[model samples]
Target: SFVASGTFSRVFLVHPETAKTRRWKEKSHDAQRYAAKVMRENDSYIQYTSDARKEGDILKRLEASQIAQGKEVLTMRCFDSFAVVDEVGEPYWCLVLEWLG
Candidate 1:
């Protein structure tokens, strides 16, 4: 479900099983979940989209900087990103990151 909203996007907390539409009636498994920051598709998307990408880029730079100094970033670790087109043909940019909790 939705966790929060930022200047340009909303965040959703999702589990590994959330990827599939149908749930399996089996034993539960331990897996990593993620916090997805999805870009807002609005009238200002043309400008906000770039800013949204910059957010991920900044996170990567911070982690890279810490790694270069022999340190580890324990928060907001970005995993992957992609664009999902909606029924209205609007492209929503998404950034998948490590969920802190």
Candidate 2:
């Protein structure tokens, strides 16, 4: 897992390798990065979830094409999804995205 984090979801800084074997680095604010919009399953607002799903679908299609073309895709180019049990043990799905900066 790459450094995972977001405002709505609990962000974890994950490395591609095992957590113990990987080093953590903070992203520089001045660096160029991609922005990925992720879905927050626990969002009280239903509209947000709907919009996220729509965006995720569109992004997946675009990423598939880019990957096929051998283009340089940013981390944000691909959307990673996960589901976790909240403190109450309720399942929540989160979308991990690259920050466009």
Candidate 3:
């Protein structure tokens, strides 16, 4: 389920497959963690959720512009896959993200 707090819907951490499968740097490397920001679909604050989606779009635009200009600006990747989660009998709108360590 997604959470609605302030301007953010929900935030979580996930370990990307690449991070887990890649060989670590032995004693020099710490476990990598990724941060995910999820947009809320059901909430009392409609503007907040709308802003959340807008934020995602902004990030996407930045990434696109950077790529077109041959520059790297965004450090994290975001996706647009509609997520529906069932917690008990209630369904929730959630966004799954990779943890940013």
TM-score of each: 0.70, 0.44, 0.51
In terms of lDDT, model 2 sits at 0.52
Task: Give Cα distance to truth, residue 13, candidate 2, Å.
Answer: 2.5
What lDDT score is found at residue 51 in candidate 1? Answer: 57
Q: Candidate 2 at residue 87, lDDT?
A: 79
- Per-residue accuracy of model 2 over 17-89 as CA lDDT, tens digit each: 2234335765444543433333355454444334445445667778887888998764354456655566787
Cα RMSD to native, each candidate? 4.4, 6.8, 5.6
Top model number, TM-score: 1
lDDT of 1 by residue, 1-101 (tens): 99998677788998765444455665456667899888843325445434556667788888888888988785477777777776898788888888887
Model 3: residues with Cα > 4 Å off, grouped in runs:
1-7, 17-32, 42-54, 74-76, 89-101
Best by lDDT: 1
Residue-level lDDT tens digits of model 3 in 1-101: 22235453556665445533446545324545655555555454554335445555666777788889999766455555354555665544444444443
**Following a full C-alpha superposition, what root-mean-square deviation does model 2 have from the true structure?**
6.8
TM-score of decoy 2: 0.44
